[model samples]
Target chain A: MNEEIVRLEDAWVHFDGVSVLEEVDLSINQYDFLGIIGPNGGGKTTLLKVILGLLKPSRGKVTVFGHTPEKGRKFVGYVPQYSLFDRDFPVSIWDVVLMGRLEHKKRFKRFSEEDKKLAYDALETVEMLDFKDAQIGKLSGGQQQRVFIARALVAEPKLLLLDEPMASVDSPMQTELYELFEKLRQRMAIVLVSHDISAVSIYVDKIACLNRRLFYHDSKELTAEDLEATYQCPVEIIAHGVPHRVLKEHK
Target chain B: MIEILQYEFMRNALIAALLASIACGIIGVYVVVKRIVFISGGIAHAAFGGIGLGYFLGVNPVLGVIPFSIAAALSMGIIGRRTKIPEDTAIGILWVMGMALGVIFVALSPGYAPELFGYLFGSILTVPTSDIILMLSLNAAIIAVVFSLHREFQAISFDEEYATTIGLPTERLYLLLLCLIALTVVLLIRVVGVILVIALLTIPAAISRQFTHRLSSMMFLSVFLCAILTICGLWLSYAFDLPSGATIVLVSGTAFILSTVSKSIHISVFSKSI
Candidate 1:
C-alpha cells in the first residue's frame, strides 16, 4: 500500500473569477490525523471538495491514492457537515449507512448480505447499532452526526474527510467525538476541517492553518503566530482543559 | 358499484385509476420527500405541448407526449443545474412555454378541440384500452427503474452532496429521476389531467409519510391509499354523474385535510395526557 494518501501540488480554486483558495500544497499520509483550521470562506470546504473531485482546482494538480481525484475518491469516506440536507427524508439509519457501499456495488445488483453486514459493522463502530432501525430524522443532532459518520465508514475507506463534524455536536459530547476520531485514525488517514480551533487542535496529529493560502505544519505544535496568520488577527491558545481556547483577548 | 363496473367506460376508468395509483404511489414518495412537487407540476403542464403537437401532427397524443415531456424534463434538468438561472425560474419558464406551445399547436390544427378539456381536466371515463396498455407499460418501467436504482435514488434524495462524495453519479441519477418524474407525469395526465396531476403525484405519498418513516412502507401505504381514494372517487362520480377527474382530486384533498386534522388532534390529546 502507498504511504501517501493525498497530495495537492499548488492547488488553486476560484469561483466567478474570485479566488477561494490559492497555492495550497499539502500531502496526507497513512495514519495521519490532520486537522485544518480556517475562518469561514477560507476555502476549507473548497479544499475538501477538490479532494472529493466535486470541484476541479483551477491551477494545480490534486491526487488521492496516486490517482485522479475521481478514481481516488473510491477510497475516501466523507462526512459532510450536519444539517446540510433535509432531515425529514424517510430513511432509517441502516439505509443511510448502506449508501456508503454504493460505489462498491455492481450495476443491476441489489445490496448483498455482505453489504448489510458492513453497514451493521459501520453502525456498530459509531456506537449506533441500537438505532440501526430508527428513522434518521428522529435522532438528535449529535446522533445524526454519528449516523452520518457511520454512513461514511461503511465502505471502509482508506481516507476519511470530514467537514466541521463538531459544529452541531453539544460541547459535552465533543470530546467523545474526538476520541472516536482518535480510534478511526488508527486505521485510516483522517482530514477534518473546522473553525473550532480550540477544541480541534488537541485531537489532531498535525495542524494546517488555511486562509485562502495554507500554512502546513507537520506537527500539532501550532503557535499563536500561525493562528494570527490564519485568522488575520492576534490570537492565543489557552490549553486549560476540556474546553481549550485558541482565541484570546485582542488587548 | 358492481353495476357501474359493468359499463366498459367505467371499467376502463377504474383500470386507469389503478394504473395511475401504482405510478403515483412509487414516484410520489420521491416528489414529496424531495420537495420536488413544483418540478413535477412543471413537467405535467409541459406535457400539454406534447399533446397539442400530437394533434397537430396527426400522431398519437400519448406517443407525442413521451418525447415532448422527456425533452422538457431534460431541458429543465440541465438548465436548472448548469446555467445561472434559478431553478424555480427555469421551471416557470418551461411550464408556461409548454402550455403556450400547446395552445398554439392546437390553434394551428383544424377543427375545434373537444377532447382538449379532457386533456386539461381529465376524462377517465373515456379512456381507451390502448391507453390502458400504455399506462401498464409505464408502470412497469417505473417499478423496474425504481427497484433497480432504489439505493442510488435514496442516497441522492437524502443528501446529494454526500452521495457524490461516495462516488455515486449524482448528476446522472438526478437526471434519471427527472426522467422518471416525467414518465409519472404522463401516467398521471390521463387520470387527473395536467392541471390536477400534481395532487395525484404528491397527496397520497404526503399522507403516507405522516404514518410511516420508512421509504418502502411509505410507498406501499401511499399506493394503497391512492387506490382507495381513486376507487371511492370513481364510485361517487358514477353515482352522482359528476366529473370523475375532479371527484378523484376532491377525494384526495379531503383525505389530506382529514389526516392533518386527526394528527393535530392526536398531538393535542397526547399533550394533555402528558
Candidate 2:
C-alpha cells in the first residue's frame, strides 16, 4: 500500500436523527485524484466535511496521515462553494490570500518575506497574479473561485478538498479548471465533489458514487453495469474520451 | 478653553473622549465589516440591565454591567447561530427585555437613584478619574487583540467555512470577537451613552472604509476621524449648551452622510468624463 493518506472505516453520520452517511468505508492514497459524484442532497459534501474535520462522524473513525481528522486539518486545504461576499468589503486579493499563513505564524509576529512569496506563488499558480491588488468582490465568478483556490494553495497542504468547484462556471472555464486540476494532481491529493459526472470521469483516477452509501468504481474500467448499479437507474455509458456523456436507456 | 481644563471634571471628560474614541474606532471596524451594527446597538441597550442591577445591589455600575453584557453577547451568538429565528428578531427581543428589566429593577429598588439618568443619557462632564483609567486600559487591550489577530479575523470574515477547513478555530474566534464587542460597548457607555454608542461605533468606520482597501489603513483612518469628531462635538456642546451625546452622534452622522454624497459625486463625474 502506497501509504494511505486518508482512511475512513465504517464512518456513520446522522443529522436530526436521519442518517446522512451509513457504513462508509474509504481509503485514499497519496496523490490520488478522487471524484465524488451523486445527485443533490447526497452525502458527497458531507463526506468532504468529515474528511476536513468540520463535522464529526457519529460512529466509526477517520484518520488522515496516521492522525485524527482534527489534528490533520493543518495538512488539508479546502475550496468551498460560491460564497455570498459583500461587494463593499475593503480587502484585496493579496490580503485574502495571505490569511492562509496565519496558522503558521505567531499571533503577534508580522508576516515574513517567505510568507509573502508563498502567497504570490500560489496566486501565480492560478494565473491570478495580475489581479492581486484588485478587490475580491470585483472579480467574476470564475476569477473568484480561482482566487479561493489560490488561498487554499497558499497553505501548502498535502490534500485539497473542493465542494462543487465548477457549478456556476461557464463551459470554457470549466474545461480550463479541469486542466488546472490535472496539473495540481501531480503534487497533491485531490477530492472533488462535483455534479458533472461524465466530465469528471475522464480525468479522475477513481470515482465514488455517494447517495447515503459508498459505491466505489475504478475510472480506468468503468462499465455500463457499474453506472446503473451506482445510480440505481438505467444508464447507457457512451465511450468518448473528453466531455463524455451518459444517456438513460428506454425499456 | 484653558479655564475649562482647569476644572477636574472637564479634564476627565476630555480623557474619556480620547480613550472612548480610540476604543470605538477599533471595535467599529469589526462591527461594520461584519455587518453587525444593529447587534452592537442591541448589546449597548441591553447593558442597561447591568447598570440597574448595580444600583439595586449598591455596587459599581461598570463592574455590574460586564457580566450582564457578556451574557447577552453569548446569547446573541448562540441563538443567532443555532436557531431559525432571524437575528434581527432575537436582537429586538433582547434589547427591549433588557431595558424593561432595568426599569422594573429601578422602580423596585429601596430608594430612588438619580445617577441612573446620567447612565441613560450620558454625563461626560461627570466622568471620574478612575473611569478614565479604565477606558484607557480597555482601549489598549482592544487594540492589542485586533492587531494580533488581524489575519485570522480577516479570514473568518471572508469565508468562515474555508477558515475552519484550514485549521482555524472559527467558532472560538467568533465568540472572542463578540466578547471584545461587549467590552468596547461597556467602555464607551460613559462617553456617548448606550443610546448613541452604536452611532459612534459605526459611522466613523463606515466613512473611513470608503477611502481605503487595507484593514490597517481603515483602522487608522477611522480612529483619526473619530477623535476629530469627538473633539468637535465636545466643543459644540460646550459652546451651545447642548447635550453632549446627541451632539457627538450628530457630528458622526453628518460625517457619514457627507462621505456618501462625495462618493456618489466622484463616481458620477468620473463616469461622465470617461
Candidate 3:
C-alpha cells in the first residue's frame, strides 16, 4: 500500500458549545480518491475544514502527509464549497490561477515564466486555458468550478480537497467533472465532500459516511446494509445505485 | 494657474494634493474591496486622539496621528481576527474612545486651541513644504510596497481562505494592508480632514469598481478619478468660497452616484440583448 497521506485519530469539533464532529477517525492513502457524503448539517464541511487546518480539532490530531495540517498546507490544494466565494469579486482567471503560486514567489519578484507555464498547464487540464483572461464572475457554474479546480491544480499538491464540486453543475458537466476527477486521481489523492452519493459512488474508490461521527467504507461497492450500518437508520439502496430510500425514510 | 503656482503655500498645497491623492487612491482600493469603510472611518476619527496629544505636547500633530491611527488600525485588525464580535461594534467603540480622548486633551491644552479647528476642517491652503515632502515619501513607500506585493494583495482580496490554502501569509498581508491604510489616512488628513477623509478614500474607488474588472485597471482608474475630483474640488472651492474637503467629498459622491446609475442602465441593456 502507498504511504498514508492523511490520518485523523478521534478528531472532534464543537461550535458554540454544540458538538459538530464527534470522535471522527479516518485515514486516507496516497493517491486515494475518498468521497464523503452525508445529509445537511452532518459536519461534512466542518470535517473538510478541519483537515485543511482552517479549524482546529477540539481533540486528537490530524496529520496530513505525516505533518500537522498547517505545516503541510503547501502540499495540499483545496476547493472550498462554491457558496463561500463572492463571485462578484474582481479578478481574472489568469490572476486567480496565479494565486496558486503565491507561496513559491519571492517578495517583490514578479511571477516567473515557469510559474506562468504551470498555470497554463493547470488551466489546460481543466479545459479552461482559453478563458485565461476571463473574469471569474462571468463564467458558468461548471466553468467556475473548473477554474477553481485549475487553481488548486496549479499548486501541484499531493492531496486535493474538494467540497461539493458537483453541487450546481449540470448533469453532463457533472459527468465530465467526474471523468476529470478520475484522471486527477492518477496524480494525487482527493477527498471530495458531496451529498450526491450515487454520482460519486462510481468514481470514488472508498467512501466515508459522516454525521458528527464517521463510518468508513474501504470498498467502492456500498450496499444497503452498509448505508444502514453507517447511518444507524433503516436505509434502502435503490436499484439506480442511489441511497434514495435512506434519505426519504430518514427524513 | 501660473500665478497660483508662484505662491509657496499654493505649491505646497498642490504637492500635498498630489501625494494625498495617490495614497488615498491606492489604499482606498483595499478599503472598498474589503468593505472596511467603517473601519477606515474609525481609524480616521480615532486619530483625533493623537492630534489632541500633539496639541498638548506642542509637537507636530501629523506625527501624533500616525502612531495613534496605526495603533487603532492594528487593534481593529486584531480584534476582528480574534473575536467573532461584529467589526462594526469594535470600530464604534474605538471610534468613540479615540474622539473622546482627543476632545479631552484639546480642552486641557494650556493655550487657545486655534490649531485644532484647522486640523478638524483641514487647511490645505496653508500646507507647509515639510508636510509636502513627508507626504511624498510616504506615498512613494506605499506605492512601492503595494506594487511589490501586488499578486498577494489580489489573492487575499479576492478570497482570503483560498489565499491561505495556497500558502500565502494572509495574516501578515492583512496587517501590512491595515498599516498602509493607517499611513494613508495620516497623509490624507491634511487634505480632507478626518471627518471627510473616508469619502475621499472610498467614493472614487467605489465608482471605479463599476467600470473595471481588473485590479490594476481599477487602481489606475481610481487614481485618475481621485485626481480629477481633487482638482475640480479645489477649483470649485476657490470659485464658490467653500470648504475644500467638503467640496471634494461632494464632487466624489456625485461621481459615484452617476457611475452607479449608468452601470445599472448598461447592465440592464446588455441583459436585454442577451
Please list the residue runs of candidate 1 whose C-alpha ends up more than 4 Å from where it truly belongs after superposition: A241-251
Candidate 3 colliding pairs: none
Docking class of 3: medium
iRMS of each prediction in angstroms? 0.9, 1.6, 1.2
Candidate number with the higher lDDT (2 or 3): 3
Give the number of the best model, judged by DockQ: 1
Best by the lDDT measure: 1
Candidate 2 segments exceeding 4 Å error: A198-201, A220-251, B1-8, B78-94
Error of 2 at B191 (Å): 1.8
lDDT of 3 at B32: 88
B166-263, model 2: which lDDT tens digit per residue?
77778888878888889988888888887888988899999999998777788889988988998888888998999887898898899899989999
Worst 10 residues of 1 chain B by lDDT: B1-10
Q: Write the per-residue lDDT of candidate 2 for residues A202-229, one digit (tens) a residue.
A: 7777777777887774344445565566
Better-scoring candidate (DockQ), 2 or 3: 3
For each candidate in the order shown, give its overall lDDT on alpha carbons.
Answer: 0.89, 0.83, 0.85
How do these models rank on lDDT, best leading?
1, 3, 2
* Candidate 3 chain A TM-score vs. reference chain A: 0.91
